[model samples]
Target: MTPRLFAALPVPEIFHKEIRRLQKGVPGARWRPSANFHITLRFFGTMDGKQAEDLDAELASIAMPPFDLTLQGSGWFGKLDPHSLWLGLRPSEPLAELNAKCERAARRAGLEADSRKFHPHMTLAYLQGTPIEKLTRFAERTGGFVTEPWRATHFTLYSSQLSRGERNIYEPEADYPLL
Candidate 1:
């Protein structure tokens, strides 16, 4: 069976509480379980058995040193369908390099390249009819947010499915450790 796949950096649990603390006051905001938090490296859409193996090999070939990452600040995007709130990440050259590598890996695996630029952030919630004012206030409340630097040593391949509650469930398919 073909499975939808994505490559991402896992958010360490030490920052989970801070992320959950901001999940208030936004009506119609579908807050995600902290379990779903991650900084996506690249989305590979759906891949068949052979394609998945090829992508796995391409990812395994990627060699990069582990780097420190910090989750800081917060914001939201869109008023239409893709409306969502997110916690921002401090930009890192190493992260960008890894993301570019993931993109190239997707291409080598016979998948179409992602057309959008990589913007790293941990998604906090999906909004349906969240008030604009509440979104602004939530942003202001989280403005001073910062987390201690943590070592990012690996990335993972995840597969997701829609659950009974209409929530998306994510499961780790594979882990690719970094140098």
Candidate 2:
């Protein structure tokens, strides 16, 4: 079966609690559980079995050095009416390079080069007609948010399956380790 997939850097388990704490007080926001926290490198959409295998091989061949990443601040995707509530990531050159590589891997796997600029953030929640005031307040309150630094040792290819309750269930299909 074709699997809807993406490449992402999973937030380390240790900081899950701290991340979850920031999800409160946002009305009309369907918060993501800690288990679903990830910073997507590339969203591959749906891929057939052959494409999935090819993508896996392309990603596995990437040579990237491990780097430290820090999560900080909070923000939403849209301006007036928010589309998603997310925690920001401190910019890192290594992280950008890694994302570029993943984009290349997607191209090698015969997918179109993802044209969107990489916005590094872990989605905390998706908004559905959420109040502008509430979203603004949440962003202001968590502006100083910063997590303990973590080393990114690997990136994972995840298959996205829609589970009950409209929540997405992401199953890691492969791990591409970095040196």
Model 1 regions lying over 4 Å from their true place: 79-82
| Model 1 lDDT per residue over 55-169, tens place | 9999999999999999989888885444899998998999999999999988988889799988899999999877788888888999788899999999999998888898988
TM-score of each: 0.95, 0.97
lDDT of 1: 0.89
**Clash pairs, model 2 backbone:** none
Global lDDT scores for all candidate models: 0.89, 0.91
- What lDDT score goes with residue 76 in model 1? 88
Q: What lDDT tens digits, residue by residue, belong to model 2 across residues 86-140?
A: 9999989999999999999899999997889899999999999899999888989
Instruction: Report the number of clashing residue pairs per model.
Output: 0, 0
Alpha-carbon error at 136 in model 2, in Å? Answer: 0.9
